[model samples]
Target chain A: MPQPEYDVVIIGAGPAGSTTARFTAAAGLRTLLVDKRQELGAPIQCSGAISRHALEDVGIVPDDEFIHEAIYGFAIYDQTGERHVHDYRSLKPDEYGSGPGRKPLGYVVDRRRFDRYLLTQAERAGADTWLKTEGRGYTPTDDGGCTVHLRRYNQDIDVRARLLVGADGLQSQVGKWAGLQTHIKITELAGCLQFIVDRVETEGLLEIVTGHEWAPGGYAWVFPKGHGYAEIGLGVIATMTDKPARWHLDKFMTQSFFRERFADCRILEVQGGGVPLAAPLRTQYADNLILVGDAARHVNPITGGGLHTAVAGGKIAAGFITGHLEDGMPLRDGALRAYQDVWLDALGDKMWKLYGIKTDIFHNMNIRERDEQLYATMADYFSPTSEFKKI
Target chain B: MSKQQPVLFNIGWNACINCGACVAICPQEAGFVSPFDTIAVDRPCDIACLLCEQICPVDTITHVPAPAPATQNGAGVR
Candidate 1:
């Protein structure tokens, strides 16, 4: 009988995995984090916008290193070019902070730097990390642990661990291999595209353009990234259109009002990806295996925002795994099932309701006819004053 | 080097961003992120679901007449 090399082996070194490692390793567990990328956060897939409180929730402070710009609030534009601003200054003036010393409602971050910072924090907390290492698959052992197969340095390697944490993002193989039903339908997925452009004017607000005319099954956004640059992107449901997300974005930038605004702007970079709009996975854990972050579909159903949820999910995963190992709980088929229930109590309820609202608003509807009304409905649901309780 | 299996389609690497949407939604687990960080479909196993083609936001994965057999260690960059 051979002992496992590490107490826990976390696949993926994104925010979720790193946060999990930070807590588990700090608790004296032999935690190992693996990522396929040679660089920790290259080829960014996210918009990199997150609430300020979200970073703070995980004990992370907004620093100049990764903070791209401070967001004061959101400005939503309807199809008619009508605008509605949700200013945090009005709701929480004190927290908004004023002048150079002011705090922001949210922030746009440099994801590459932010992700690297998180992994560095995890390593500093005593976790071992392997870069350019991909988790090929895993096989659960009879002893209630698993052997993770990996491809590293062009060679295959196997590692045994008492617990396997699947923090892998969108294309997570670990969760699917673990039989968590991670499949997403075309209608339930948002195909997204973005361009980081320069020479675009931007205020401190996150600008959102809604209506099918702008984006058939999704919406477009202009998120400030500081220093006269911003990310302009949109997402479309593949089932709703024959054209790709890029086509819609192209039309939006050239045929719409943005044509004038982006006339001289330079396209610095292009980013694209798929976002799962489905409900969170019902079971986030199976035996000694736990799925956190996007792997567990912890994203906000309507907004498609997951950074905050990912960080929080990581913390929850770490807490439960640490507790299970410390309690000497039998690592059987259901030893860690409590993690999902706990996560549900903490965050899953709101997500489920939001998923319902998302279905009501976008699923199987005539978007063009109801565009403005739909935009108003969304605004009400998202307004700071409105309780999410209303349908 | 072991001979790789035959693939049903060729990935358009020039435009692919390695987002892994194909890998996430593939029913047969045939689509995977190659060691080079690009998306690759496992040979002799894709079942021609074409989900990868439909799900790719960039529309970079395309079906081909016959993909040349690959080697196990090759990056398959094409």
Candidate 2:
């Protein structure tokens, strides 16, 4: 009964939750960010490879401490061991605004530090944060808000807030309890495995290997993590195969292309999880509730990328919450629903395009046929432009 | 695609987040909620179908593949 009432309560302290808390509290509204885990970034559920613009786009400085490596382009390997190295080097600084000059394709981050760093930002902005707190559920209050039931280290408490934001990843209980169906189709859930290993022969380039033999309906990745350390992982369509991801990783490790190169490597860590890559949910906001990040299924369908979406989404959610709390505007139905409209205006087309590409191209093609067609197409696409007729 | 049906499937308690996705998506009424209403449980793999395995969001429901049939084909797929 002693828990303080707040204007906003965000469940889950990952990137999305922290970003929303950061902006909401900084705008002078009372905010609270809660996570079930003892540590902000424990278990390290991500590949640590995030788009370089993820931080800056949300107004955070991309500090050097968290950056592990800069990727130039991709080296794509197909089913038959055919390699197509494409040089889609990033654009100049002018293209992305006042950022670094001549950017790389992306960056590999120390995600543990990155998540904690964002938490610090939220704390500095005056948001209250609670770790090791799990949300049991919630019930509607008469004042148009809800009382969230929480268990803090075996002790139960109730906290009241006008707005509830669920950033609780793919298995969001907050969203489900708030009357939003958070489950996606099995065809849309991407089960993934990641391993941090040494002795990787990557030359500052990202490697993507695709084939049914390696990963069914998806590709395996080798991300450069600097200092000869690499994060290798794969996502397989759950509907495509019944085999465990570890079984696939063992087979991938023994491939002739990777056997000798990874011979003496030691695996530092292993993490497994699922990513929801369906289109952003039909409604991430209703009444006084909202969802963001993986909970809202905002991940890019093709690459399963989500860091950028989480940051952008957090910022957009805060914008709506702040306006409603401070400007004396309504917070239900039409006004609050605009949160989704504003964000889709900012990022909808890109997500839909990636979804189309994922469903239309990669997901439908069997491994062998995709390899042949992809190899032939990229071979020409990345080849030096040739002059057919001088006239 | 003609492998023998699995006789048993074990659900990993550690991997389950109790999302109720398996219960909602299973074609058969194999999945159910326990007494607490938080954690979920499944009946068994007697259906010979892998729908529960496919529908598990966390990949926690592991399939136990049946031993290879003695008369299965031996032709190389590649």
Candidate 3:
């Protein structure tokens, strides 16, 4: 039997794909999400930290099932271990008014479960999902729709879609298949290594450490999970490191601060990955294609945070998609370019300014000067929530 | 330069997620890793940097040793 044609087919079931699928499917478009893994969120690759407002903006209400811990605020430490804290409650009263859920500034969640939950939302919204499926390429139909070639488990088949949304992450094959330039320059890539440490005491404070002795172009972080669990990792700018990222991470793990904290801890998980520092793509749409999330280079150039952007961008894409599909616009019509314009208008300026400032101020300065300047303008980093840009 | 062997076979087929860390951390001046293409390392360019192997997040890369001269098995077995 042949698979039913879909109005919209999204590749990758991550936050962006799931959110877009939810919105599109809920709006009555036949949507399907395809993932390479049998499970939705295996091989977890995120730091699992997100702001409360960001989560709320994405329509995720924190639940114990996936929400690990509440983060009141986070702190930054210089090489000498002198700390500067960003207390959300005290610092951003105007932005985040007193409320039941607004007290805790953010959350540390089980990213794997959170990702899966997002998939469930999409499924509940009437979208279908194919697990262990991979998209090799697509051939455009005469109607401007595409016959997407997919390999599901051991079988090959062609699925049809009028519009294709690529949320396939930093190494998005969908973007490449659509003939989009998604290559990240080496100098703009940040290498990260993390360990889930158990039996570590966390004071409910998320720690961001800055120093040349550790991560030169980037920073080290300790995001709490609970009473005795947290994720400890450091990201190194490629231009500053000569050896494997693990070598520097290992040194960081041995530091007196980390050593004392994790002395009684055992490593429960390991995660390594890279975050792109490029500004949002100049063009995020082509033909009948739309790219969202990390695939569109929506990650923060300095903090590397992208969850909010992924969710918001997906929502924005879904809005445009809904209009096109509902308006009965043919696949060949130029309406799809609206997605590109809307997204660029929504995110292009913020991304460009952030990337420029990050490269000029953070990347160009000495570690000491960087820390000094960051401390001087404590609100500059987190108050406006500059790193966590929304769509 | 000698023809370099395929050091990491099927590097991005399944487990590799194309994080771009390998490219950023490659010690070789000429080494390149991309999900779009397969030529990650080459003769004189790599110089056996092996940094890609060490830094791969999923550890999907492996090196295959070059074959020795094919001799009479009985004499070479020792």
Candidate 4:
């Protein structure tokens, strides 16, 4: 096998890896993007609901078919079963629909299609792409580069790179190999189970219901993906007091509340995974290595949305790597620390505050009080005129 | 009742939801829900004000005051 040297070697072809590859390639870096799976975006694990601002920030505009629905606003249901609906259109006429008149909100995306679109974009940007290439391990070199070991078709191949990016998901082997703290406390980890069911008539609205009875420290989401397909799932924090997430998901899916709504639906895919609900790693970089996306624990503490953060982090990682390469600086602790600082400045404090609030509400508040306060806060946050601004 | 210095308790700010239940149920008017949207503990009037702690729905409130030193025989134990 011919040995190849790349300026940047990115693991996992998910959103983060692809985005990193795109940015680095565009910056004239020799980038190699690899994924373990034979296909990209298969066996989905996300609800794929992202804020409108996140998409525009990353410069990704979904085509009509890929966009399931344009969300009007949000409806939050509290533990006491009271619902509060906030329509952005009614509150802000200037931003209520698609185009100039469309609401400046968000869209529910078809995750699989979206991921594929991003990977395609990376390829077009000149990234050397390899599918079904599983990252085995890496050994840091004396000069501050890395020898990335990968397995393709059961054959081990070694590739060298000046920098390594681990965009792997929650259980990231890359993070471990790079000597970063990757273990998530049971309480901070959310075990989620979901099903993509077809033929379910769901409004173009996103629903988030929170309570111990429903999910216990987490929440259930109903995201419509058009064409009668919807991503429905529940996330439960794996705290000492809470049962396993699978049990809660099974109970919710079979319960009367969801059974009636999904009785006639066909199961398109059964997906399950764990998400780390913590602040981004205090140290996301070291010599010749950096982490992004779930590997860096960038998922939102409040909503558990990670796609946007992952993409953003990926772009930052690319920028940092480009600067390092152009300057011929050693990919040492100090060099990579710049990447960590930039990301923390971008979204760190917000995540920490949200984490604190999540713990407080779940542990101390009663159902009634918790519900009321949560609804009020969300209303204020999502309202067009509310001062609670988005980060 | 002799006036005593208020004992301050730092209720986990994260766990508080700004509910006035604790304030309403305090017999000594020692507990007030602050407008900053947090729970405050008044130690002066609270001869161990466990009411707010007990009524807390999430059990996030904890008494962090040190236990009084025990006396051995007729002497005070340090």
Candidate 5:
């Protein structure tokens, strides 16, 4: 029997895969997007904090319905309790530079709604959606395409495509199968646990606390989602420690500081996840394959924000794949290399540089010193009127 | 003519976080942490200057300058 065929078979229907499917299908390519999840957005692991620049980059306009809060700026505190508040709204253009407009820099988003919106967009663009289907593996065909093996609820099937894209999260089996190095160093991985609490009064400011007392080699964040709801979470660098992430989170959440602050709130949902604090992969593509989003390691090392990056990567990948298909070129190493070079040129170099600075800031200082520096620097770093602003 | 001695430095690989800060800021690409459990050092002769140590998160590295030459009598060394 002839194998099932598609112009593109994308794995893991998260932001990356969905965006790629939307763009490629709109370009008139036959696309099939698959995910293992029963629903579009469930089991949320992210803190859902994205930059204002990110939304604009992905062409996503935040409305009152989708956004949780409109954040003006961030407040940083150190181990010794020294606080520094940086208001992005009050900065002067001479001190910072251009692009420091009066708009909110970003907002905390509802992950479920945001993801579902992206998927809906993809569906509207004419891509076949395959929920509850898990990609098992793939074998390269002699005709410069690939035959993907998949299993759905104990039933096996196959799909053939000229190109494959992997947008799965941290534990991406697709990345591993594609022979990309997905090994995360223990210390570079931040084990995080978060809880969304309702009836929590927040001042529309994102709070970040740095110190060993809160989380070693990591920080705790309280992101206000507005309407008396907030997402509170902490992350710790996973070294050789045998303790789970929840243990550290429990230790911090039950402390006098957190208890006193959030005593009146009620827990709505508990989420735990791991984020990779590293630079984007040096080579995100191979023969007949491309990796996007978390699978491509496009996460920000400082804030762990990946939604925007994933969308951007997906758009770039779709453009490349569309061009390749148009030219009737086989998805060979040279063609994929072009895709890698263009994307990296656009985003990878800057991210790598930022990752370097983030590593230096976190690794060289003790908890107390880090907190102090953050408090001292945040004003200048984020203030529109400060010379160091531009992050 | 006097003889020259080579200096050495020991980097504790186990404590590295693979953050790449050292690689980015290092004037000499002497310090690099790979995801594959390998720490690459380009020139050992550059050990006299220990900039990477200052930026290291865990301080797992120690730079050892060359030891003074021994006396001919093998008594107390300089």
Candidate 6:
């Protein structure tokens, strides 16, 4: 029997792959989305916070089923108890919403549900999906296509595709197979760990804590998850400290302020993964292959956030590939250069600037010093006046 | 007495959450032992760059020198 084939084979069913598959499949391309996990979003790795603008840009309405809490502002805390608050409600009506009521700045979601919802959207748009399917490797074929070798249920399956996409998160092997530079340096990688806890009081504000004492080379966060629950987590540069992220988190929780506040809180769940804090990959595509989401290191360097970029990058990939396919154009690096150019103009430019600021502010610092200037710089970067805030 | 030609690391599977940080940054792709048990560093391609060791959040990977190489007689090898 002949092996099944598709116009595009997307490895990973996360937001990036699903969003890309949704667009490509909807555009009448034969698209397939696969994930190694039996379930779409099990063993969640994200903090699940996404900006309202990001969701709007991706055309995904914030449904109540996945939205855990509505965030209106941010409260940034320095090492020495200094607090700075930015409230989105204070934004001019034109800057936020045209409606009578004040709109939320962002939402903290249940990531598992949010991811599942995205995959469901792609499936509804006519993308084929396979669970518990792993992409072991792939080889470029003649006529500018590739054959993806997947393992499902101890069975080997090969599917040929004109285009292959890597949306496989931080541990993506697709980019490696395509010979794209996907390796992250130790200093550029942030090891993150989060705990779901209840009885922690947080209003509508996402609390951000910055200090070498707390997170070393990264930062910590307290995001409300509604119903009096919250996710308190932190990311640390693995090379900056001899200890692991869990140790830093444990020590952070024992701080006098957190100790008293979280004394009665119950630890409900734990999640952890690595986030690439490096600048976006210089090249995100090769011949007949493209990478989206964390696979392309679309994450924010300073904030270690990628949900927004993942969605946006996926959309761009879908548009670029669909337009090329429709034109009967060859899927070569020269043609795919447009994807890189457009993405840089839209989002990558800001990320590049943030990456510079991140390296300057976070590396080789005095961990004990209360650097108010550093905090001010961070505040400015995220402030309404900053160009990065536009993303 | 026996000689050791290669060094291999043993992964503490109990402590591993299979987050794949080791696999992501490994230059030689030496961290993955299998599709199901991907946490083990069973590959002989290890250059001892120690990036995987530093990147592991749980410190579950430990460098354990492989047992001595077999002698000419090969009777002492376990």
Off by over 4 Å in 1: A1-4, A97-101, A388-391, B1-7, B30-33, B36-46, B65-78
Candidate 4: TM of chain A? 0.91
lDDT of 4 by residue, A1-391 (tens): 6779999999988889999999999999999999877667665667777777777777777577457777777777665456667766666667775567576468887777888888888999999999878888888888678899999778899999999999977656677776676655555666666777887777666777766677776777777777768877777755523354556666666672666776777778666555556666777887788899888888877777888888877887888789879999878766778788877777666777777766676565576666555566655555666532454
Worst 10 residues of 3 chain A by lDDT: A382-391
Q: What TM-score quantifies how close candidate 2 is to the native fold?
A: 0.80
Error (Å) of candidate 6 at residue A113 is: 0.7
Q: Candidate 6 chain B: worst 10 consecutive residues by lDDT? A: B30-39
Task: Identify the superior model by TM-score, candidate 2 or candidate 4.
Answer: 2
Residue pairs with clashing backbones, model 6: none
List, residue by residue over B1-78, the lDDT tens digit for candidate 6: 224344576678787766667776776542254564344445443366667778777777777666566789885576
Q: Please state the error at residue A138 of candidate 6 in Å.
A: 2.0
Query: How well does candidate 5 score on lDDT at residue A172?
Result: 67
- TM-score each candidate: 0.90, 0.80, 0.83, 0.77, 0.76, 0.92
Indicate the TM-score of model 3: 0.83
RMSD of each candidate?
5.0, 9.2, 5.7, 14.5, 12.4, 3.1
Counting clashing residue pairs in each candidate, in order, gives: 0, 0, 0, 10, 4, 0
Model 5 regions lying over 4 Å from their true place = A92-103, A240-243, A256-259, A365-367, A373-391, B1-78
Q: By the TM-score metric, which is better: model 2 or model 6?
A: 6
Interface RMSD of each: 1.9, 5.8, 6.1, 18.5, 12.0, 2.2
Model 3, residue A364: distance off in Å is 2.1
Model 2 lDDT per residue over A166-239, tens place: 89876666666756766567777766777889887776566777777787766688889877789888877677
Query: Across residues A136-252, which tens digit of lDDT does each residue of candidate 6 receive?
Result: 888878778889899988799999999889898887778777677777888888888888998899978888888788887888889998888999998888878999888888888
lDDT of 1 at A139: 80
Candidate 1 interface CA RMSD, Å: 1.9
Candidate 6 ranges with C-alpha deviation above 4 Å: A90-100, A363-370, B1-6, B29-33, B36-38, B68-78
Please write out the lDDT profile of model 2 over residues B1-78, one tens digit for every residue.
Answer: 535453455668786544444443343332133432222333334355555566453567765644443554875333
Fnat for candidate 4 (0 to 1):
0.00
* Highest lDDT scorer: 6
User: Which residue ranges in model 3 land beyond 4 Å of their true spot?
Assistant: A89-102, A256-258, A330-335, A362-367, A370-379, A384-391, B1-20, B23-78
Q: What is the lDDT of residue A42 in candidate 2?
A: 57
